[model samples]
Target chain A: MAELTDTAQQRATGLLRDYGAAVRAKRIRAAMYFVALVICVLAASWSGEVDLRKFVEGLPRFGSYFRDITPTLRPATLGSDIAEWYWNFPVWLELLLETLLVAYVGTLAGATLGFFLCFFTSANISGNRTVSFVVKRALEFCRTVPDIVFALLFVFAIGLGPVPGVLAIAIHTAGALGKQFAEVIENIDLKPVEGLRSTGANWVDQIQFAVLPQVTSNFASYVLLRFEINVRGATVMGFVGAGGIGKELLGSIRQFYYSDVSAILLMIIATVVVIDLLTERLRHRLLGTAKV
Target chain B: MKPRIAEPCDIDRLRTAYPSAFAPGYARRAAALAGISAVVGLFIFGVVWLGFSPSALVQGISKLGVILKLMFPPTAGQHMLVYLQALAQTLSIALLGTMLAALVAFPLSFLAARNVVGRWLLRFLTKRVFDAIRGIDTLVWALIFINVVGLGPFAGILAVAMSDVGAFGKLFSEAIETASPKPVEGVLSTGASKIQEVRFAIVPQVLPLLLSQVLYYFESNIRSATVIGIVGAGGIGLYLSNEIGQQSWDHVSFIILMILITVAIIDAVSGRLRRSIIGAQARS
Candidate 1:
């Protein structure tokens, strides 16, 4: 009877100890999260000029603004040359085509450049450390500057047209795709290249026969993906006066022509959907997963 | 039979094995591959066609040098306060927009994932919706929102949110599809409903990935907020563009510096947080 009582006492202590440890852990986690939340709130308030009073005062304005937006779907003014506005359809279509053309050329150029640069950029393949460092930094600098800034600068330098937009997109794509391509190259199996090297093949010959074949499918898929992104980018180049559908969209917004804006948006959405579908199909085919 | 003298047959075999060393086709293939070097020629042609003369560059460099001479030590005059205010606005816009997008995209991701939805048509349509939204750049989305909501940070917020919705949906769905199926199967076998299974199993598996992606997008959205500000969506970008337009190169340099510093800080913090989250998930 005495031993049985002792065993029960030990069991009770162990259970309590386990419960205490769990509670302590839970408290620590909760405190850490609470501290983090406080920091976030403080940082946001400090950086965003957020003040309760100002926000409260602005609430009514928000309501009035919603009221102002009620007549958003205004019909075309009865006598106001709807025909002239309707003529914009052809122009919009042409602009859409131009956007596609720019994306195509840019993607092709960028992919070609990126493919070659991948060899030099890959740490395993590079001949010299200095060369790799310079190439990597150059790509970083190219990508760090947003594409819009590039478009703006190109517009200033090259004068207005789709040329600047294409060049801008190409430069950006080269930077982005070059990094991705280098990663793909680095991840490739080295056995094939080693086999070629053991056969007394030169470095260039080894890369050509072994490395290129292994990564071609992945490289193709990346290029297709970049092309899809570039299509969207090309459409927006018009905002900087580099040229595309964005110009018309900007015009509609400036004039407050809601219907026309809607039409242009519809066109853009449709174009994007079609391109996306095509890319999906192409990617599957290139990856040899067509049956799947 | 082997005792008969073998005169350098190994070398002879090696030479015979790769006869392409002497073949013209080997050189032709090399040339074709190396043809990419011709891009330099195209670059030169573009320079000439675009009238980018070396002299013009040199002249512009001198002009830029003169401008740099004035932008000394970054003036913290009366406009400093205004600059800080605008910077804060930009950060808030990015934060609010990212939060909104994350909230919406987190649940939608499960519906969009092929493995979760278990229907090709639903998956395809859901993915297409994401694609359509993402296919329009943030700047264009800003323009659309500006028309709908009028000009302000509110418009910028909406624009960023809309653009991110597509991106987040895609990223989240990919994460869901990649999650381990074991826990999900176990939960389902316990007579749990589909929703319960997903809630108890898949959510835990994907939560860390979703958080990391959301954090990354937030870092990115900060940069994007600046861009949309150029279109009068009310952020530091508006000030930056105005400075550029006014040819205040000094102010432009200062603003660019601010952007760089802010982005760097956010990236470092988010990177640490992401790693910790991932580490915890791995441990669990």
Candidate 2:
């Protein structure tokens, strides 16, 4: 009994020593990371030209910029003041509509393309390994180049219009959605697929009957999410002179038309918020009833 | 379980009794058809409204091919050093912006979390604020910052930081809310203050997740930081746009390649880091 107690104490001491060493090692690792973080922060500040004095001085200007963007309104002429502030309302509205259309068309086209590509890309569906590998890399290239950069290229290629905007958004969307759709396809129950195969169903038929039903709702949800992102992307497409209210917004900002800038900004924010809410509802509805 | 049909007569009776289930009701089929038609109709309308023509697409593709041909034999020309500097600045902007955003978001996220903030109204308002900030594009923020602070990478950093704050706040708050409550209760049972309880329990649980998210954003922000310069916010983008303006295809391709390589490298590194950190937390 005495020997047993002695061994127990020895083991306890050994365990505590090991724990202490581990704790010390963890502390050292944490300290090193902290030091690295500090170094990076300082280096970033230096390279980014983050001057404290400039920032402090700019603070008041920042407040003023916001203040300046706010239209002066009295209780008496609030309605007219609002109207006057949004003087280019008709033009901006038309552009906003165009932007929405661009996003819509882009999403539809992209989702359609992704729908086809995902079958080819999905590991369980695609039998051709080389084809899948090549297509996967192609999709990566499409998405890796940011949509705006694509817009810039398209604008150069196709001449400036909403068409380039649509194409850019579509390509990026296809790349992004294809990857997601492939993931969804990869995760579907394979039993249905196996059963279809046993019945001598062709590859295309199997995909259509077994795979499409399982992934459609998920694909729709993802497409809607892409639409939301594309809308935001479309807003900035005009920055590259592709088309939309962004060009107007940029022009106003550059020419220092503060109120117009604010007006357009407000319209954009409102549109995004409304779209976000609508899509959130749609996504919930789709996902909530997905079991069906 | 239903009673097994032992005869053809019973099958006939079941089919008559559950005709709608056996063949989906007309209304349900009609609804599905209508939904598909509506989607198709919308696509057609959008195509027409956007003036999307197959011929135009073909023309554009050919034009793009010509331009892509010009992009071959990618070269930096005389501006390699300048381009390198700009790239570094973009990296700096992304890093600093992510750090600042993380700092601002870390505490504010607590106020937005349902479990941390008792008041529903406050939490709702906080979330809305995050949404509003996030709704605005990063470029718009860059434009605003440029106007206020004048043009430079500073504006780019501010823009990235501003946009990321909203994103980080939302994600961090969600992370905090999802944290297991057992640790919180254990800490509370020790008669610890609320702050102490949070410090000892919640932070440790969510920190790994939050850090991983922050790292992921940092990787993407590098890409954004590259673009903000097109609007005079400062970075490689200004040079890129300038090169494009001059139709310097070789330089354009070189710069694009650089951006791609940088993005790929960051993605890999951040992915490894996130996995390691999360893995460590899981083990602990």
Spell out the clash pairs found in candidate 1. A47-B88
> A85-168 in candidate 2: lDDT tens per residue?
999999999999999988988888888888888888899889999999988988887788888888998999888889999989
Question: Considering every candidate listed, which one attains the maximal lDDT?
Answer: 2
- Candidate 2 local lDDT, residue B37: 97
Query: Can you tell me the DockQ of model 1?
Result: 0.24
**Model 1 misplacement above 4 A:** A1-27, A49-87, A192-203, A289-292, B1-85, B113-128, B177-182, B185-195
CA error at residue B90 for candidate 1, angstroms: 3.0
* lDDT string, candidate 1, A223-248, tens digits: 88998889888888888887778888
Calculate the i-RMS of every candidate, to one decimal place: 5.3, 1.1
Model 2 - which docking category? medium
Minimum summed lDDT over a 10-residue window in model 2 chain B is located at B2-11
